[model samples]
Target chain A: MKNLKLIIQREYLSRVKKKSFIITTLITPLAIGLFIFVLGFILSYSDSEKKTIAVVDHSGIFNKPADLAKSGNTSFELVDATVEELKANFEDTNFDAILYIPEIKNLYAQSHTIFFYSEKSPSLDLEMVLSNRVKNKIRNFKIKELNLNQKELDALNTSVDLDPEPISDTAKDKSKHTNAVAAGLGGFMGFIMYLTVFIYGMMVLRSVMEEKTNRIVEVMISSVKPFELMLGKIIGVGGVGLTQLAVWAILIPIIQIIASMFWGIDTSDINQLSMDQAGIDQEDVMGEFSMIMSEIANQNWWSIIPLFLFYFLGGYLLYASMFAAVGSAIGDDMTEGQALTIPITIPVAIAFYIMIVTVQSPNSNLAIFSSIFPLFSPIVMPARLAFEPPIWQMILSIVVLIGTCLFFTWVAGRIYRIGILMYGKKASFKELFRWFFKQY
Target chain B: MNSILSVQQVSKHYGDYTAVNNISFELKPGQLFGLLGPNGAGKTSLIRMMTTITSIDEGSIFFNQEKINSDTPGLIGYMPEERGLYKKMKVGDQLLYLAQLKGLSKKDAKAKIQSWLDRFEINDWWNKEINELSKGMQQKIQFISTVVHEPKLLILDEPFSGLDPINTNLIKSEIFRLKEAGTTIIFSTHRMEQVEEICEEIMLVNKGRAILKGNLQEIRNQYKKNLYEITLDQSPADLSNLPGNIQEQVDNQIIIHLEDDAMSNEILSFFTKQGIRIRSFKEILPSLNEIFIQSVEEVEA
Candidate 1:
């Protein structure tokens, strides 16, 4: 036990003290801040270039164009000219383009196509704006000619929002709005879990390979058991992973504050501007944002956080042991390392893909089975946690994951004990299997 | 004296191949022992079993008369043929880690590491990374790491392979110092001259079996043929009718192979009868190199 602790201390401190670790930990948040700043800068300047379009409505319905709905960066002006004359002398005019609306013989036609003539193609936004304004004017004229009450017709249109609520006693308190929030949060959690497993699992693999290639394993194993060395490394690297995550969790918000103070890029202001452009009410958006926030606040985080951590650690250990085995089996040949790593990575990749599907339909049979299966549960189960997967499924998943982790660690320990000593020969899957089963 | 370490019919097999077959030996405390073997001759396998890095397939190993187990590793210091330290780690930190792994407390490890560095006159190298040092310097550090914990038994495999003459002498003095302080040392190498100079007892292994072992001088004497070298004051005119077969004649010295019935006194008297003054006469024994090769070849044949 003391040897294990010493090994863990060496492994942890050696890595944590590296300059590369410190640099990466501090630079990642700054990089993210820089990216956001650039994005905001581009978005605020995207529509600064203005364009003018001359409207020649021969149908005379748009005689008063001042009342037409206007889009940002574009304005429409009524003109008294034929399409042919405008096309011939468009450069002579100050307008960027000419919108020609032909005279309509039947006002109740199903559809009408208008032409916008210019040397260059008109922007899609400008086209949509002009077409919508014309369409609304024609509709209003039709309503007036038919003697229809606009207020009553507007009232007749109805929208239905079907909010589902589970009748089960366990899920009696869950709301549809909460379910939406859960889906988003669950998918994010699953993605984070996937990244953690891949990144830290690979770290363990490379650390093992370093020891083997450096010829340090023999000296190390002489003092401590191979199993202790491996376990200590896994736990130690896991600690580093946790440290990095904690640092990021704290640094990202602090970086965002400093960035906002410097550039004055108020995200909420951007949201408000977009909302105003979309013709949405400020009160409606604020109400929706608060409801989502409240839904997040009302969640059972005590259970969810602990369960997430369990799955995160469980999945990391399971894959990390397999990676360590492959690292030991690989003797100088990196191509062989890749071949051995494929088997371990395939399951992780598959779990991530299934997580995407599981979040969409949390109650599907595939989701239920995969959530309970030990291999995929680390990712899939957490994805369904916010959706409140059945209590039994979560418990079974945790139990199976822990059991598999222990089994793999044992098996990997066997392979490592032999692999670290065997050199000059590339180990195939057959060789690893033989080592795994060989008596010690 | 009780044996510090004893191996009894220990064996290790890798699938169909036998690495160490029924090998047994014992080492007295404070003895500088040599474990000599050719490449792939099961020397490493035997050392690993003794160090508890691998299990004994068929027999048992006892350290200080207690059956070897996990705790035995703390009492043994092993430096493998292929040995290295973490290149990115500082000398002091790396040595401290290795010492702590051998069951030393942190404070003791730190103090021992500092004293070792001061002894080596490399106190400034405590903060230097292993990669920044030259190969000979790294070798010195590796040797220090092995002995810092001060184990009862030290096993060094090819410890002098990469060292320069100066560094080799430095490590050699340290090995002697440790042995003088009552540490049993097992020096494994195929280099015979060093063994002849340093080792008191020796074991020669070939093809996973011990072909020769015992006190170094006794083994040499046992393998010596009936050969003798004689040096006269001058070269004799009539060299014919000598009692033994002449092996080689160089100036005043003559090396002859004697038959079973012939004697060295008889050869001296013959030179005296020929009116030649005899200056020196001695029997010639084989060197450890010749004995090692001949034994291995005899086993092969």
Candidate 2:
């Protein structure tokens, strides 16, 4: 136990003292800050400029000038002008586009005759906004011509937007539709989990390879048991990874806050963005944002954080042991490491790919299968946690993951005991298996 | 004399091929023991088993009559044939780390490492990375780490393979010094001259088995073929009738293998009887190199 501790200290300190580790730990948060800043800037700048359109409506359907559809970034002016005149004056005017409607008695006939002219191809946003407004007016006109009461039609429209109410006793929370936030956060967490596991596991693998190639492992094994040395390394490097993540977790938020303070990123801009996207007013957007903030504040972080750590450590050890085995098995070259690592890496890659499936359907069969599987659970289970999966599944996943880690660690240690001293020969699966079963 | 380590019929096999087959030997405390073997002769296997890098397959090993198990590794210092240290680690740090792994406390490791570096006259290289040092310098660091913990048993495989003459002598003196300080040393190598120079006891292994084992001088005497060299002041008119069969004749000297019934004194008297003035007479015991080759060949035959 003492030897394991010393070995862990050596492995951890040696890596943590590296210039690369220091540089990356300090630089990653800055990069993330820059990324968020750029993203926010882009979001605010999208569709900021207003465009005017001259509407020459020959159909006279939109006769009420006050009833014309207008938004903050788009406005329409009714003009009595021919298409030829409008086209000739299009470039000289401040108007961005000209919308022409030829003479028609009905909506079906107007569809073919309506023309929109612009200096360049029209933006999809502009096209969507104009077409939806025109369609709504036509629908209202058709209803009125049918002798339908407008208030009754509006009531029918209101009834179609049915919002289901939750039962008083069984429902966990007030929010029924948290899929949007869950998908975003869950996807982000799973991806980062996969990436960190992969990065740190590969570090352990390379570290073993370095020791073997350097021939230091012989000396090391003479002092400490191979299993002890390998376990120490896996835990030590995992600790380094966790430290980096912990630092990033703490630093990024602080950096983001500092950046927001220095750069004056107000919530109004975010509200404006939401308003533009949903075509809702500022008050509705403000209400939605607060509800989201409250939901975030009420999250069960105590459970979520420990679970995240469990998956992270479990997944890391599982892959790191396999990597260590490969490191022990391979000769001096990295080619064998690459080839062998593929088998270990595929499960992680598959787990990440299934994260999207988890987001789409949290209780999906594929999501449950992956979460239950030890290899994929380290990534999949945490993602499913965002949807508040049944407690049983979490327990099963954690238990299976821990069991798999223990099994692989033993197998890897067996191979390592012999492989570290083996030189000159390229390792084969047959030989590795023999080592696996060989008694010490 | 107290035997520090004893191997009782230990054997290791890989599939059908035996790596170290039923080989046994003993080392006295502070003995400079030589382990001589040809390529793939299982010297490395025995050394590894002794140092706990690999476990015994069919037998047991003991240190001070106590069975050598996992806990015995901390008492053994092993330097593998292929010298290895973390190349990116500083000399001082690497040594200290290895010493600690061998069960030295941090403070003791640091002090021992300092003393070792100073003894090697490499104190200035304490902060230099391993790759930045020359091969010989790196070897010095490797040697230091091996003994920095002051283990009871030290195993060095091909310790002087890549060292220059000066470094080799330096390592030799260090080995002698360690022996004087009561460290049982196992020196495994293909070099025979070194065995003669320092080894008090030796074992010759071939094909995973010990073929010869004894004190160095005793083994030499046991393998001796009664060969003698007689230096004459002048060439004899007739080169016949020497008591021994002539092996080679150089100017003013004759090398002969004495017949089983003949003696060195008889050869000298025969030379004097032939009126050839003898300048010097000497008996030549087979060198360890010659004995090793002969014994391996005999076993092979």
Candidate 3:
């Protein structure tokens, strides 16, 4: 036990004190902060871009139209010039594009050709604005020729909104309203968790390989038990990864505040404009934002945090041990290491893919099976938490994850003890199996 | 005195290949014992088994008259032939870490490490990374880490394989000092001169078995071939009919193997009777190297 402590101390201090460790730990959060700040800045900048258009209406339609004056990011000006004249003067007047509506000889006879000219590819929003105005005006004329009344037209233009809810009685009330934002957040968290486990698990693998290649394991084995050494290393490096993640989590909100200050962005103005465009009232948006925020604030972290930690650590330990065993089993070279780590890596990749699928269909039978399966549970369970699984399922998944982690640790310990000393021999499946059953 | 280490018919096998067959030897406290063998002759396997790095398939090893096991690591200082030390680790800190693992308190480990660094004249390298040092310099650190805990038994495999003459003498003197201070030492090497210099008892393992084992002086004496070398003042006239067969004759000296019933005096008297003056006469004892080769060949045959 004392030796295990010493081993853990050595492993932890040696890595934590590395220049690479400090640099990576600090750089990752700064990078993420920079990324989020840039994204927010771009969204607001593009939101404020407005364009003016010159429209030449030869069909005598929309010339004196009262309702088709200005839209959100687009406004029109009637130009009493030929297409050539308007094209030449559009750039001088800061007109983004010139829309030429050629005269229709017979309104019911054939289609009229319209052309839009610009110095560059027109923005999709600008195209949408012009096309919708022109299409509506033409349709109105077509309706008038048919002698349709305004009430019938209004009834024909009605739009329907959908509100999707889960059918489960337990979730009917809680999940009465589903939003894209919440689903996206759950998926993003799941992905970040997978990346953390992978990066740190590989760190454990590389450390073990280095010890073996340097021949340090021979000296170390004499001082401590193999199991103690492996456990110490896993815990030590895991702690470093955990520290990096914790710092990232804490620094994100601070970075958001700093970015808000630096950019001088007024969220209220952006929210008000968005609300006006969407025809939503201020109260409704505020209620949605506060509901989302409180849902986040009141998340049962007492349960979720522990479950996240359990899966996060359990998954890493399970994979890291096998990786260490592979490190010890393979010859001291990158090619052999790569070949051997493939088997271990495949499972992790499968689990991550299954996690993505689970985010889409949390209540699906496949998701349930994967979340309970030991190999996939670390990733799938955390993602499914937003869906709120049954208590029994959570307990079973946690138990299986912990159980598999412990079992693999023991098996890995056995392989590591024997393999650390074996060199120059390529370890085949048969050979590895023999090692597993070999008495120490 | 009680034996510090006793191995009785210990064996280790991997699959069908037996690395160390039924080998047995014992050494009393304060004795420097040499474990001699050629390459692939199981010297390292035997050492590994004794250190508990490898499991014994048959029989057992006792330290201080008690069976050795996992807990015996703290009592043994093992320097494997592979010469392993964390290359990126600083000398002082690495030594302290290894010593602490061997059951020394941090304070004790620090003090011991300091004194060892001072003794090795490497005080300036205390904070230098191991890879920054030359091979021989790193070797000195490895040796220090091995003995820093002042273990009761020191097992050194190829301790002098990479050392210069100066460093070799330094380590040899330390071995003598440790033995004098009542620490049992197992020195494994194929080199015979150093083994003969320090080892009070020795075992020659061949084909994973101990081919010859006894006190160093006794083994040499037992392998003596009744051979003698003598220098004469004048050349003897054709020693064909001499009392013993001449192995070689060079310059004024002749090497002869006496007949089983004959003695060295008989040859000396025969030369004297021939009106020749006897300048030097001495019996030649076989070296450990010679016995090692002959025994290995015999076992192979």
Candidate 4:
């Protein structure tokens, strides 16, 4: 145990002191911040400028003047002119497009013809506002023609909107579905977990491959047992990975805060924040905004954090051991270890796919099953546990993951014991299974 | 009286292929024992078994009568045929890390590492990364890491292959220094001169078995062809009375080869009768390489 600690400490220090580690840890967060800022800026500017369409009202019924500003961020304009007059100078290009609705033969034609100077997909905001203004003008003309009272006119024009309420409330875990902030956060964390494991796991593999290629493992094995050397390397590289991660974890928030405070970011801008605009409120927007912010603040990171560390550390060790085993068995360089990478990587990649699809659907069966699988659990379970996961499932997943880690450690130990000594032969599945069965 | 390591009938196999057949030997304290063999002769397998690199297929290995496993390897130092120091790691840090692995405290590891670096005239190399060093220089760093704990048993395989003359001498002297300091060394090499120079005992393995194992001098003597070299007055021309094939005749020396390892009284008397004044007479000893080849060839025949 003491030796293992020594190994871990050495591994940690060697990497922590490296120039590359320091540079990468500090630069990545800055890049991410810049990406978010540039993307937000582009989106908001595009959404702010609503498309404008000029209407040529040929019929006397086109009397309602278009408003510059509507209820929300939408507007319309109307012109008193004939279709031919508007069409002659439509290329003047002040409006996004000029719409012509010729007097319909029956006034009840199922289709209306619209044309623009150039081909383009019509903007949805422009389409909605144009249809509403035309309908309003017709409705007012009809009211006057019938000489209906205001109450009857409202009754004739206004349509009832029915909102169906489900018999059951699915918002049982109010925190789970309100916004995908937790899920986004979970996905972000999952990306981090997966990336670091892959990078440093490959580092361990390379370290072994280099030593073997250099023929140094032959000597080191004499002083240290294959398992000790294998464990030492895994623990060492993991320590390096952990140190870099811990540094990033601590530093990124600091950097983000500095950047955010320097530049004012409007949280309520849907275009800026990439939020769904359908549920947006005109007056009570601040209420929804604060609810989200408060929910983010109230997250019980204390519980989720320890679980994150546990899974991250366990996942690193488990994967690194296999890397070392296959790395030594291959007896050459990085290219040879690639064959070993497929088996190691496929499960984690599958888990990443699951994390991306089901973070919002934590209750989905795919997420549930993946969260319990040891190989995938390192990424999935912690994400699910960020919100409230069932206590039984959490415990069960951890137990299963820990058991799997132990079993793999032993299996890696066997391969390492056999593989470290056998050289010039690529690690074959038949040999590996044979080695596993021929336990001494 | 205490042997530091004992290998008892250790055999190793790779599925159906036998890599090392049954072989056994004991190493005593303060003795430099040579393990001699050719490539693919299972010398490395035996060394790996002793070093806990591979488990014996049919036998046991002990350090001071205690079984050698991961925990007990601290008592042994191993310098493999190929040097294994981390090339990217700073020399001092690499030494300290390896030293600490052998259970040394940080302060002790540093101090010992510093002493070793200073002793090796490589104090300037402390901050130097290993990749910056020559292969011979890298070999020195590995050699230091191997015995940094001052282990009771040191196993070195081809410890001299890559060194230039000066570095080789420095290491050879240091190895003797280690043995004098009570470190039992199991030296493995194809270099016959090194074995003859340092080893008090040896075990020659070929085809996975110990063809010969015993005192280096005793083995040589026991397998001796009893050849003798005599340089007498050149004026005495009647030397044909001596019955043996003449192996060679250099200016003042005549090498009389023998058919068997027998006493030389007959030749001594014949030369004394010729009234030939003797210049010098000494037994022509068999070299370890010669004995190694002879032993393996005998096995084949």
lDDT of 2 by residue, A1-440 (tens): 98899889989998899999999998999998888777778767647778888998876668786656676578888888887897887778788888987665654454544789887777777776777677767676767676778887677654232334567878765464366667767888899888988899999989998999888888788888889999999999999998999999999999989877877775467667757667677786677778777776666779888988888999999899988998898859788668778888898898999987898888989999999899888888888877789889888888888889899999999998888878877787788898898865
Model 3, range A299-337, lDDT digits (tens) per residue?
566877777888889988988898878877874877867
TM-score for each predicted model, relative to the true structure:
0.93, 0.88, 0.88, 0.81
Where in model 3 is the C-alpha error above 4 Å? A38-54, A59-77, A84-97, A103-113, A118-129, A132-172, A178-182, A264-287, B231-243, B260-282
Q: Relative to the true structure, how large is the alpha-carbon lDDT of every model?
A: 0.88, 0.84, 0.82, 0.76
Q: For this target, which candidate reaches the highest TM-score against the unseen true structure?
A: 1
lDDT of 2: 0.84
**All candidates in order of DockQ, best leading:** 1, 3, 2, 4
Candidate 3 chain B lowest-lDDT run of ten: B259-268
Candidate 3 chain B superposition, TM-score: 0.91
By lDDT, who's the top model here? 1
TM-score of chain A of each: 0.91, 0.82, 0.82, 0.75
Better of 3 and 4 by DockQ: 3
Which parts of model 1 are misplaced by more than 4 Å?
A: A63-70, A83-92, A168-171, A257-261, A266-283, B230-235, B241-243, B250-253, B259-283, B297-301
Backbone collisions counted per model: 0, 0, 0, 0
Clashing pairs in 4: none
lDDT of 4 by residue, A67-152 (tens): 33452444446777665766677677566666665553444444555443324655664555556555655556556666768786
For each candidate, what's the DockQ?
0.84, 0.67, 0.68, 0.50
